[model samples]
Target: MRNVKLIIEYDGTKYNGWQRLGNTDNTIQAKLEGVLSKMTGENIEIIGSGRTDAGVHAYHQIANFKTHSMMSVYEMRDYCNQYLPQDIVVKEAVEVEERFHARYNATSKKYLYRIWTGRIPTVFHRKYTYYIPQRLNVEAMRKAASYLIGEHDFQAFSSVKSKKKSTVRKIYAIDIHKEDSELNILFHGNGFLHNMVRIIAGTLIEVGLGKMKAEEIPEILEGKIRAQAGITAPAQGLFLYEVHYGE
Candidate 1:
């Protein structure tokens, strides 16, 4: 048996999420497994690096599965692409060690949240970016984001329904970049709880809008209450940029 690592990109508009639910009719994992089973004539289980919430897209999400097939990596990619939907694409595939598990072996993950601060909604970018009509003070947002960089108990930023026991996570970086009306926030972290990044983005936007002070971030973090944070931004504006694994 050989383990095959796949680099996948999906629009994530129609599917429920990355993971397969017994009752859910559609999912990214189920689709991939269906095509793989058809091609290999064997039932295959594909494990993803992480689960992206419904409507959250991915640029380079990784997954790995074990298979015993005579097909080459190049041929497997072609075969999978032919069977996969247009919104989902298998960008690349390669054989890896048998013990390599996508989720367990992942070192870090990078996510990007796009925001459009303009008077009118952008027709072309409406699907990918969150449109906020108010003029955001980017400098204030930057100052607020600084407090989030480093290891901290992020209970205030996580969703109330998160099942994770410990909310402490290390944020390696929090970067805010702007180009005209478009604003992008990139977050690099060891891991994130449910809706953590979205809540952080929403809280930062509040600071940018002058609703919250930059100095208030530390207080919120210390509060450890989910209600202390801002709204959870829509998942449509977020993307799983990439997952890292140490070689």
Candidate 2:
């Protein structure tokens, strides 16, 4: 068997999420698997680096699959893209070692959250950003974000319904950047729990709007209670920027 690795990018607006559902084919994973399965004339199970939530986008998601087909790497990539939906694309595909597991071998992941703080409506890319008409203090948001760096038990930052075995994840850095009316928040971490980034974005928004003080972020982290954090930001605003492997 040959281990085939693929770099995928998708707009998750019309899909249920990245994972294949029990009774639904409306997922990025399922779509890719179905096409590959048909093309190779064998069952293909692709393992993704992470499961992106419903309506979230991805720029460079990684996945791997084992197959017996003799198709070349470039052929596989082009064939898959020819059949996959326009919103989803296979940017690269290559043969890899059999031991390379996409999820387990991942070293770090980066996520980006886009916020539109303009008073006027965003006409072109409204679906790609969170719209907030009011002014936000970027400095306050930056101060609140500093508390999120380093390793910590992020129970308060995750959803109560998340089924993770542990919530202790290391956040390497959290950065907030503003360009005109658009604000971008970047998070680099070892891993992220369900809804963790969204919750952090919500908490920072509160600080930016003066609803909460920047110094209160540590208290929220220490509380370790989901209710102590702010609301979960909308899924559309979040994007899986990249996943890193090895050193």
Candidate 3:
């Protein structure tokens, strides 16, 4: 048996997210599995690092699948790219350790949220960036993000539907890059809960807009309630930028 690891990139605008839902075939995982199963003549399953919400793009999403097929990794990559939809591409594929599991073995993940802070619409970036036609106080947003750069119980930033034993997670870094009207917020964390990053981004945006004070982040976190956090930023603005694993 061979454990094949795949690096995938996709424009998630029309898909229903990354996980495969029962009776719903519009998912990234289902799409890749269908092609791989056909190519290998065996039922195959791909374990993704995490489930990205609908309309959330990915720059380098990772997945691993085990199969008993004889096809070379290069051939599998080519075949998948040739057969998969134009919006989704298998950038790289290679064999990995037999015991490797994509989701469980992941070490860290980096997500990027793109925002357009301009009075006019960002014509070409509309699909990938959230448009807020107002000047954002970047420095204030930075102050709010500093509170999120360490281990904490992030229950308030998670979705109400998110049920986890412990909502505690560690954030290694929070980087904000501004180039003209484009603001890129990148977060490096051990793991994330449902709608966690989006909620964080929304909260920071509120601080930037003067609706929320940067000093209130700790209180919101301590509240441990969803209502205390800001809105869930639109999925289109969020991207699974990268996934890290132990070598």
Give RMSD to native, each candidate: 1.3, 1.1, 1.1
Tell me the deviation in Å of residue 122 in model 2. Answer: 1.3
In the predicted model 1, the residue pairs found to clash are none
Flag regions of model 3 displaced more than 4 Å.
Answer: 160-164
Model 3, span 98-142: residue lDDT tens: 999999999999999999988899679999999999889999999
What lDDT score goes with residue 65 in model 1?
Answer: 92
- Model 1 alpha-carbon drift over 4 Å, by segment: 160-164
Compute the lDDT for candidate 1: 0.93
Estimate the overall C-alpha local distance difference test score of candidate 3. 0.94
lDDT of 2 by residue, 123-169 (tens): 87687899999999999999989998999989999985756588899
Residues 1-247 of candidate 1: C-alpha lDDT, one tens digit per residue: 9999999999987889898989974899999999998999899999999999888999999999999888999999999999899999999999999999999999999999999988999899987899999999999999999999999999999985646588999999999999999999999999998899999999999999999999999999999988989889998899999899994
Query: TM-scores for all candidates?
Result: 0.97, 0.97, 0.98
At residue 190, give the lDDT of candidate 1.
94
> What residue runs in model 2 are displaced by over 4 Å at the alpha carbon?
160-164
